[model samples]
Every structure is written in structure tokens, then in C-alpha cells.
Target chain A: MSETPDTLVEPALARTPLDALHRELGARLVPFAGYDMPVQYPTGILKEHLHTRSQAGLFDVSHMGQLRLCGRAADAAAAAAALETLVPGDLLGLAPGRMRYTLLLNDGGGILDDLMVTNAGDHLFVVVNAACKHADLAHLQERLGDRVAIEVLADRALLALQGPAAAAVLARFVPAAAAMPFMSYAEARLRGIPVLLTRSGYTGEDGYEISVADDRAETVARLLLAEPEVAPIGLGARDSLRLEAGLCLYGHDIDRTTTPVEAGLSWTLGRRRRSEGGFPGFATIRDHLDHGPTRRRVGLRPDGRAPAREGTGIVDGGGRPLGHVTSGGFGPTVGGPIAMGYVASAGATPDTPVTLVVRGKPLPARVVTLPFVRQNYYRG
Target chain B: MSLIKFTKDHEWIRVEGEVGTVGITNHAQHALGDIVFVELPEIGREVVQGGEAAVVESVKAASEVYAPVDGEVIAVNQALIEEPARVNTDPQGDGWFFRLTIADPAQLEALMDETAYQSHLEDLA
Candidate 1:
């Protein structure tokens, strides 16, 4: 079925620091998360996605929210403990220069947002989805404002240099970046320009997310693009890459209605927090942990070449309703159609047969292990 | 003599006698990005003018290929089932979707000719 175009009148979209640069590179600009962002460049999403997996792809992710969470006394430990009340991760165990992925949950065990929290020595560095940033800020303020100061880093631009060759390409600018272990953070100077570098990315590749001042974002992007191994990637490829990696996209694969356990993100719930039950919806989350969720998100591999898209319904052999696809598209790396959606726990087994209803036709598919493509993180 | 016509929807129909070879214009393919899949109309099925005759899926989304005029599907391009990218590479030539027996030649008058279609594209831009 053809997707309906958004015809609602839009307010003036905000521009990223590299907006002009994206246009100069022949990007097809589109409104995304209230920002005028590049959907794809002249290279197109297919080529851009494959390029990121093989070489390095530079992404302009400045639209996401970045904030500093510090205790009243500027103590990282105190701030981490205060933040722990909001998320299910073990932020107190997050050592200096280390980062952990966690989810902000509502009182009923629903996920508010999934975010990254890094122990930045003096304070906690947090990054949340662009669409949920404002709400997350308000949530943090209303809950922990008195104990922790939430400072929005509005003047910063975030860039991700990701792929198999990302380390080598970044090393030319900051030699030490290549040696940083996965999930490690550092305040480093790239060619004398100070920036925050994190050895992490959304593409499941060895990479770095660099946070730089807005004014220098374009310069830094241009410098990285000058490298033979680096090319500018857009939101189109980013979505496909993350989808193939089995990572969730906010509001699509996950949202306020889904719990971490049902989303197959039980690992994000810290071991200590699992038993202590201090986070919001801890009672419900603990129940889900003790007894598996009624429905669990599983990867779907559609038979044949036709791609099953989001909102496509899934059914069993007898045509009983199972669930609907949350994220589905062509996985260029997997060389076939891949999808992720929730299904009854009885039908969530890998290799179980399921039918995807596409345009009123029952298309054969199977529940498969997530991450159509294997993750290649650099642990060393 | 053979005549080619274009629709405002970016579909093109090349008419020869009672049969018309149909496909999407290059502009439409470029706008849709990479073509990942194509679903052609079933042979011998009747279609109405401006009705959805086929489906072309890009990496990003799926779009309907509307019929330029009334016709009866005669044959489909089976090659696209395995090589949909051909639509992106040669949208108007080898990427022809299907051949149909024209139901009413008068319906073709509403379609834009090459010159008119070029101007129509410019207006859209």
C-alpha cells in the first residue's frame, strides 16, 4: 500500500549547523523531528547504507538533545544516584569515562524514552531522542530538578563517524580516538579543536560520536568528509542501518506504550536495579522479568522479495492475529526484506512461521533472530 | 505511427495501434529514489483511466503507478520481479511495466504530450 504523505501545514522547521553544507552536497531536505534535515544525498540511501557498513559514514545528528546532569554540589556519583530513580540502568556503576544505555519509564512500566548516559567525571552527560527531548527535559526537571541541575547544551552539534574504518579515519584527527574502548568517552582535541568524543554509535559499527560547538560543526564535518574513507550519510541510511542492527527507533520500534522487557531490552535493566525495584514501574517491570511478557518483539524475515513495512499485521497458521510490524524495510546488507514487531510469546520463537498481511494479501514470513546483520563493535 | 503520452501523475504510455506500453517517467523514478520492488497488474485484467495499475516500491516507501488511460492488461514485465532496480536505471525504456489493449483512444487526449509534460515538470519544480 502507498504511504500517505503528511499534508498538514508545518511550522518553520529549525536547521542544523550543517544544513547549508547538506544542501551544497545535493541532499534532498525533508522535515524530520521539527528540523530541516537531509533525508539522503545524491549517493542515495542504498549506496550510503552499504558504504557505512564497509567504510566510514559521517552523520549529522545535532538535532538530538544533549544535556548535563550535575548534582547541587557537582558530584557525579550523587547525580548518578539521583538519575537512577528515573531509569532502570545502574548509573552508579557507570565508571568515569564509561557510558550506558537506559530507558526512562512511566509509572506503569512503559518506556518514556531510551537514552544514553555517560559518567563525565564531574557530571553525567545525557543524550535523548530529538522528538522526546523536550518532554524528557520537563520530566527530569519536575522529578529531580532540586537535586540535579539539567543544563541543555543547545549550542552543540553531534556528529557520528561510523563504520569498520571509522577508527582509522578518526585517528588521523585525534590519534588517541582509535584506542578508546567501546562505550568510552573522552574530552579530546581534534586538530586543536576541543570536542567530546564517545566510542559509540547507533549503527552497531566501531565508531565515534563527536560533540562539538555549533560554529565548528561544519568545519569538523568537512574535515571528516575530506578523508578518503568517509562520506556524508543521511537520516535515510541511518534508519536502515539501525533497523538492520536490531536497534529501536523511538516512536516506531519503541514508545510510551512498550516496556523494555517486551522490547527485548532486558539487558538495559541493571542487575542491581532488577532486584531493588527502585525505578518507576518497578513493580510491573519486575513482574515482567519474573514472568515473561505476554507479547515480545521479534525479528521477521519475509519470504520472497516484497518488503513488509511498518503497520503490517502478522498472523498465525490459522490466521489468528499475532501483532503488527513496528519497523520494516529492505536490509541492503541482509540482501532481503527484514522487519521487527511484537508477537505472542508462544509465536515469538525463532524460525516460527508467521504470515504478514501486506495490502490484504497473506505473505509468508518467519520469526528470526534480531540484527539481520551481525554487530561489529571494537571491544579493545 | 506510434504516439507517446504523459500523465500529470508522471506515468507514460507509448501507444501503437490498439496496444499501449506503460511505464513511469524518469522524473517519477528519480523522485522515488531506488526501486526495490515492483508489482505489476495481472494479465487480462481490465483497468480504468487514472486507476492504480501497478505498485512500485522504493527503499523508502511504496507508490502506486496509476494508469494513464483505460486499458486491459495484456502482458507484464516479469524481469522486474528479480531486478526491480531496472526501473531506476531505465525508467521509460526497458523498465516498461505492462502492455495493455487500449479501451478508449479518446482517453489519451487528456494526457500531456512530451512538450506539455516537460512544462508540467517545470511547474512542479
Candidate 2:
């Protein structure tokens, strides 16, 4: 058994083929997503984040959970239906090579996790964070047992190549990669190794996420890094990139305590599913969907350069507490400060003035639309 | 060129006459990761040694940059107000955080010389 304490504690360390490369890059390794991954590099988070937005950045994301679902046609469709019972998306309409983002709901309609499900020709490919993988797998098995074949792709590694020049940079090696449109995926070969490539990323840029066998991951990453456009980006840039993109971080922006509707993710719900109501916690979700929620997620723009980080309390003019910041940072791309938080539904409107209590000082903040920076996804 | 001294907290002070240019070390920037925002002190603000002089935040954590010596802020790096990552890119050069008029030139005794600070970082490694 190759199981060690570090491996057992963080599945990412045990799985990522580029783990050694991260160390070589002088990354400050930390336990994240059940794997020891680099949080930052010697260049620091701000530079890394900006560099990725301006150029191409390579990210080792092998710790994310990858799974394959297989069964007869009807059985697979039934399995999709079963999975849909827990999330809000229309899984039946998901075409082959296409992907959709959705949330896993609890019995109370609260979000358990947000995940991606892709229709791969003969099977469904699902990816989730390492921290939520075990629970998600158990939940899927519990709900759709015996009807579908659930297999964890433990030997595969995932890499996110993101930035403005991602397509141009990746095309040099993987020519077929340039053809994949945003949210679509395809199978290709790199260095004689067959791989799965998808046009998706967490950073607000055009990018591709490649899934390759563990043994060949290092070679592919090195090949990509050899290009002047590609640099190794750590978790720090990854966090800021996603934040600027206005995407939710699993633990911070989403948790068991928040519901899909409250998080502004009701669009993931399929029209047929909304009326059919077959999924878990459908009634609760429908109730919030129809009547609206008491609290909603809002984006905040601090007036000054100071950052209002997570856990910062937000208040009204009279100092009455309103909400707490879930995720906040100085967006390198937007060239200022931005934050996201949960506030009373009444206080959650664009241009609403609020105050962030940071270090015993109330900082001026204005409610703004999410994605402090505009996303530049390559639809074509 | 003047002798550069570093603090255990990672701020650096380079004395030239009665003024000292204060900024975080490259090692400090590397440790803090990506810098998203920097809170600079007002020009002419008087600060005591070891007191909070500024706040630097990265995507992961927020840290206070303490005054290396009792001084009066004479100038601040206004460039960081719009582009904070400049500190991460050129922390020692273009990223000089502030220029302070040293109140007591003798306070430099408490800091580490370049050799000593390099050894300290080596020990950490």
C-alpha cells in the first residue's frame, strides 16, 4: 500500500504527477483539497495573478476529484436523472462533449457542493474538489447505487492552462486543443500520450484544462512551461484569479449553510426539472426560487485601496450589522479592491452603500455586480 | 549607496543621511505571496518604532508592515496605490514603500545587517 500520512491527509499529494515540479518552482506548499499544493511562489501572489491575466499561467490541479460513470444507455440516463435529483441542472439535455456547472443540494435545499459534469461520448465525466470528493462520491453512490458504474480516475492528472494567450500557447504543442470551444471538451494526444482537453478554467481568461495519465503529466507540464508564455502559477494566483472572475470558492462562498437560490445559482436548474420536481430538496429550492431568499450574495467594492477580507463585518449607516464578507481581495486585474459577501436580501442591491468593519475601522463600500473584472472566456 | 538593514518582520531600512527608505524585503514579498493591496501611511505622519506603519494584503493573508524605527513619513510609494503588485515584482527597487525622516539614528542598532539577515533566512530554509 502506497498510503502514507501525507497522502492520506491530502489526496492531491498522492495523485498529482507535477508535485515534484511544484517544489522545484520554490512554491510554499500547503495542504489544500486533500493534497499538498503550492499556495504561492517566490514571486508572490499579486505578481503571479497579474502575470496570468496578462500572459499564460500553468496550474497543477490534479487534486480535484475525477470520476467516470458508465452503464447501458437507459441506465446512464437514469443515473443522470438521479444525479439531477440532487442538483438544479438539466443533466438529460447535456450533449456529448459538453459540460455544465451545478450544485449538490442537501435535504434543506442548502448547497453541499458545486461541481462540473461533462458528457464524454460513452460515459459521464465528473470533476469536484478534493475536499468534497469523498462525500460527493458517497452521496452519488447512495442515491444512484447499482444503476451506474462509478469509477474514480485516480491515475489521471488535471492541469489548468489559463491566461489571455492560453490558446496560442497551448496550440503549439497540442494543435487539436485550439479547436475546442468554451465549455466543450475533446480527446487529444500530447507526446504520444492520449489526453482529455477542455476549454474551461477558473481564471477569467481563455484556457484549457487537460487531463492526462499521472505518469505523463510531468512531461506535458514541462513541455508547456518551456514556452515563454507559460509560467507556473500557485494557489495564491489561483484564488485571486477566481475571485476576480466572480466565481465562488467552495468553502468560502459556498457551504452547507447556503442554498443555491441564495447564492444566485438558480440558473443551473433546468426548466423541466423546475416544474417536474424530482430532485432532492426540490420543494425547498422551489420555494426559495419562487418567493426569493431572505439573504443574497453581493459583491462589494471598497472605496479605498484597503482590502476587506473574509470575516469582515458589513454594516449600514447606523452601524447596524448587515452581513459578513465571504471572500475579499485586491483584484490585480480590476486595479482596485473587491469583495463578496452575504447580506440581508433587502441590502443586496447594486450601488447600495455599505460599510466594512476592518480592524476596528469602518471602510466605505458600495454594492456592485459580481466579477469585479470582466471574464474573457473564448467562446469560439 | 548605504548599508541596508532588515527587520525580523521583513521590512528593510536603508539610511542615507537623516532619512531612511523603508520597504519590505524580497524574502518578505515572497513569503507573503501575491500582494493585492497596500495601505500606506499619510505623508508627514509620525510613527513610533515597531508600530503598525502599513497593511499589505495578498490573496491568502493580511500582514502589517511595522515601522522599523521611530520616524516621520516624508514620502510614500504612490505607484502602489494603483498597482500594488509592483512590490512583489521589484520589492527592493521600484517597490520602496515609504521614505521616513529618522527621529533617532541610533535605533538602527536593533536591526540585522544584510549578512546577518541572509543567515537568518538560511536558518529558516
Q: Tell me each candidate's TM-score.
A: 0.98, 0.86
Quote the true-contact fraction of every model. 0.46, 0.46
What fraction of the genuine interface contacts, i.e. the true contacts, does candidate 1 reproduce? 0.46
Best candidate, DockQ: 1
Clashing pairs in 1: none
- Stretches > 4 Å off in candidate 2: A1-15, A41-44, A72-75, A169-176, B1-6, B13-23, B34-36, B41-51, B67-114
lDDT of 2 by residue, A209-276 (tens): 99999999999999999999888998878988998888999889989888888887888888998999
Here, model 1's chain A TM-score works out at 0.98
Candidate achieving the largest lDDT: 1
Error of 1 at A262 (Å): 0.3
Which lDDT tens digits does candidate 1 get at residues A1-380?
A: 23324223378999999999999999988888899888889999999999999999999999999999999665599999999999999999999999999999999999999999999999999999999999999999999999998999999999999999999999998999999999999999987888999999999889999999999999999999999999999998998999999999989989988999999999999999999978999998898999989999999999998999999999999999999999998998998889999999999999999999998999999999988899999978
What are the per-model DockQ values? 0.56, 0.29
